[model samples]
Target: MNRNDRAIVALVTLGHAMVHTYELSIPIFVSVWLASPAFSADAATLGVVATVGYGLFGLGALPGGVLADTVGSKRLIVGCLLGMAGSFALLSVASSVWVVAVALCLWGIAASVYHPSGLSLISRGVEARGSAFAYHGMAGNVGIALGPLAATLLLLVLDWRGVALVLTLPAVLGAVLALRFDVDERAAVADGGTETDGGEEAGDSKADAVSSWPEFVAGSKRLFAGGFVVIFAIVVCSGLYYRGVLTFLPEILGDFPSLQPVEFGGRSLEPGRYVYAGMLMVGVVGQYVGGRLTDRVQPSRVLPFAFGLLGLLALAFVPLSSVGLLPVLALCGVLGVALFVVQPLYQAAVAEHTPAGTRGLSYGYTYLGVFGVGALGGTLAGGLLTYADVGVLFVVLAGIGLAGALASFVLGRRA
Candidate 1:
């Protein structure tokens, strides 16, 4: 990797990390707020608020993709950071439910831009695509692990408001760093310099021209015609499974007698947060392994195994939890690994299947399915838990995973 590649990787990696940090940090705040008398909200009402935020995260991806192409990926990324920081700042000062909703909405909109912009930058700008994707995914896993850990630790020291304010620092720092780094692939393509390694030219000179809604639609149409629609469907199913199982994972883990108090650093910590964060930490290995595999094996081949196993594990999670602590912990670790392993596989698959011309828009729709439409999983989980047992919830999640597995299998054949 050259200096430019290092800068791009650093920028995108930081961007991906911060996005997950802010996202996962919200649940911590929700837990805190639910317990506080200030909110006076029931579980169901708070769940709805969280759902709104999650839904908006998904909803904002389309326009975010368009902006990535229009305004430039770097600019959009910087905007995402600044926007997330501002959202956190707002959240820090939030006094009512409505204010929290507004802040979360802002966060959703801000965070929506990152996938399209950062992934587009990597797919187009970086020389080592697979390695970059691996490192990027690994960075995301790091954030996934650290976000809850940091939030939980911060909660012990200060109020949730203070935590939100402190969390804003990272996005601000990331934004400043992003501004200093100049590795915009779109700009490079416009300069007629080949930025990608032996890859296709970024796009035609006409692609450098400004894109409007009509052109954006036409590009999406082309992507669909090129068989990316199948990938989109696969990602949607993956999203549903991912969001459903994880939405209440910490609470689910809290049900385990063995996980009642996870000890660390001579302190008995909250089992739910540590267990959840530990499982997410295991995903770092999965991210790195899955990422490296994409450079060697066919990404399609990697997809079915990971997705299918995730389905089986989702079904096994409840039964395993009833058995003993070690088995349940093992299952959670495997679940985390399987969950993240498919990410890089499909991310690489998306890059492989789409043309450079409309890659950002393709990623936009991809994330729309992954995050936007996927946000429904939280609501789905809430409804199921309200009416049914945990077994039923896992069964539904298993079904979603199996559906995704089937989609990936079909995608493999089609691709």
Candidate 2:
């Protein structure tokens, strides 16, 4: 990669990792919330409750996408980092579930802008798009795995509130780094033909201020009319499977006797939390592989295979949990790899189906599908786990994975 590509990738990589760090950390908190005396709520209630912040984390992508196009990505990304820091700070002092929900909403609104802004920047600025995405995704998976691991370790020494305070440091430092970076935000798009809004000049800087609602809607219409419609369904299915499987996975694993808490040095240690974090850590391999494949193969071609793997893994997750500790840990690792392999594939699919001009808007819609509509998976898993057995939950998850596979198969056929 050239200097410009390195700069752009570095910026997005930091921002992407920060976004997911907090995103995955919430589940670790959810497992705590279920057990904490501060919240007099059940898993189903907390699931629906967590969805409040999680939903906005997705639902706001539409407007965030619009802002990315209008105001430019760097500004939005900087604000996102700062806002996420503040949101977590608020969580540190929250006295009730209502406060927790409010803090999460703050987090959601702040984080909602990252995907559109960061991904759009990469799509528009980076020359080595696929490698940049791979590096970017690896960083995100790092956050995915480490965020929970960090939380688990911190919980050993600090209260959850103190842990919340510590999470703020990274974003604050990231925001400072974001402001210092000298990046060519439009290096890839400077070739022209990408900044037009209904024939007017829609430059990235404020002098031109690329703003047009009518154009946004028109662009959205064009995007969905093409292969993006199928792509949208595929991402939504991805979202459902992601949130459904991950939202309660830590708690679910705790149910297995094989993964029960161990007496270590006179203290009970929960191995399930580490297993949960390890599962996500293994996803780094998936992200790297998926990202490399995006450069060498058609993402649509890989989506079906990846999604099919996810379905099979989901179907087998519960059955294997009872086998033994090693088997269960092995299943979690495999499931994590299969689950994340679909991400870069679908992300690449978005770029392929849409134009560079509307890249932010397209990714906005993409995340909206994954996080917004997909936020329901948390509620779905919570409800199922409350009223049904682990068997039923996995069955539902398997069905979602199969559905995603089918959608991608159609998309691949179209491609």
The model with the greatest lDDT is 2
Name every residue pair that clashes in candidate 1: 58-372
Q: Rate the local accuracy (lDDT) of all candidates.
A: 0.82, 0.87
**The candidate that achieves the highest TM-score relative to the unseen native structure:** 2
**Where is the poorest 10-residue window by lDDT in model 2?**
196-205
Model 2 — TM-score against the truth? 0.95
Tens digits of lDDT, candidate 1, 152-268:
898777888999999999999989988988774743243463434554454563364238867876787777896588888888888888777777777667767777756677665
Worst-scoring 10-residue span by lDDT in model 1: 187-196
Residue-level lDDT for 190 in candidate 1: 34
Q: What TM-score does each of the candidates earn?
A: 0.93, 0.95
**Candidate 2 clashing pairs, residues 3+ apart or interchain:** none
lDDT of 2 by residue, 1-415 (tens): 8898898888889998999999999998998888899889898998998888899999988788878877888888899999999999999999989999999999999999999888888877887888888999999999999899999999888889999999999999999998987888777665444532222233433322226867777878878999999999999999998999889888888879898878887766778889999999999999999999998889989899898898898888888888998899889889888888888888888887777777788889999999999999999999998999789998998899899989999999998
